[model samples]
Target: MQDMIFDNNQVLAVGSEPFLSRFDLNGKILSRMPCAPQSAFSVSLHPSGVTAIGGYGGLVDVISQVRSHYCTFRCSRT
Candidate 1:
């Protein structure tokens, strides 16, 4: 795993093929998302209740962290 963070009693891990995993405080994985062919190497949680996911070929996926309220945008470093 490249990195991980604990939020709201949930542990989020990122790395390798298991690009991301959501685990409870008890260490049981609740959900998971494998990396694509592009390969993700970095992730960040934003204070605006959003997550920024990045990968090869300058790919990025930004999603709202809020459950009830969320949004998406197609943005890149270019």
Candidate 2:
């Protein structure tokens, strides 16, 4: 795991294995999502609750404002 951030009553993580995982405030795993780069290493959240996932591959995924579920986002550069 490279980096993590908290947002929207949940913890978001990006790393090698789980790729992306969401955890509750109590530290229980909520759900696991697939990372585009597969080897994502960093993550951040926008004010709108959108998650920005960054990988060593110089790619970034901007997840939509996720509430109960992370529907989708567009991928771009580092």
Candidate 3:
């Protein structure tokens, strides 16, 4: 797994798969939702129930509370 964050007693993880997975405290996976392809290296949860994932090639994906994708974008090197 590349990154993980705790949310409401659950663990949200991102990794090499194109998925964002949720697990319990014991490490049993609860759910997996598609995110960025290939890899995701960072994850953060927002107070508004949104999730932001940073992935390969500077890709960023935003997901909503209901497990739906909000948007995708890319960061340019400055």
**Best by the lDDT measure:** 3
> TM-scores across all candidates?
0.64, 0.72, 0.92
lDDT of 1 by residue, 1-78 (tens): 666777788887666652557789999989775543145667777777676656665555565564322333334665
lDDT of 2 by residue, 1-78 (tens): 678887768788878863678889998998887766667878888887677787765667667775343443445556
After superposing candidate 3 on the true structure, give the runs of residues whose Cα lies further than 4 Å from its correct spot. Answer: none
Candidate 3: what lDDT?
A: 0.93
Root-mean-square deviation per candidate: 3.8, 3.9, 1.1
Q: Is candidate 1 or candidate 3 better by lDDT?
A: 3
Instruction: Give residue 55's error in model 1 in angstroms.
Output: 2.1
Per-residue CA lDDT of candidate 3, range 1-78, in tens? 999999999999999898999999999999999886569999999999999999998899999999899999988987
Candidate 1's displacement at residue 18, Å, is: 6.2
Considering summed lDDT, which 10 consecutive residues are worst modelled in model 3?
Answer: 33-42
> Quick one: ranking by lDDT, best first?
3, 2, 1
Candidate 2 lowest-lDDT run of ten: 66-75
Output the better candidate (2/3) by lDDT. 3
Candidate 2, superposed: residue stretches over 4 Å from native: 67-78
Q: Model 3, residue 64: what's the lDDT? A: 95
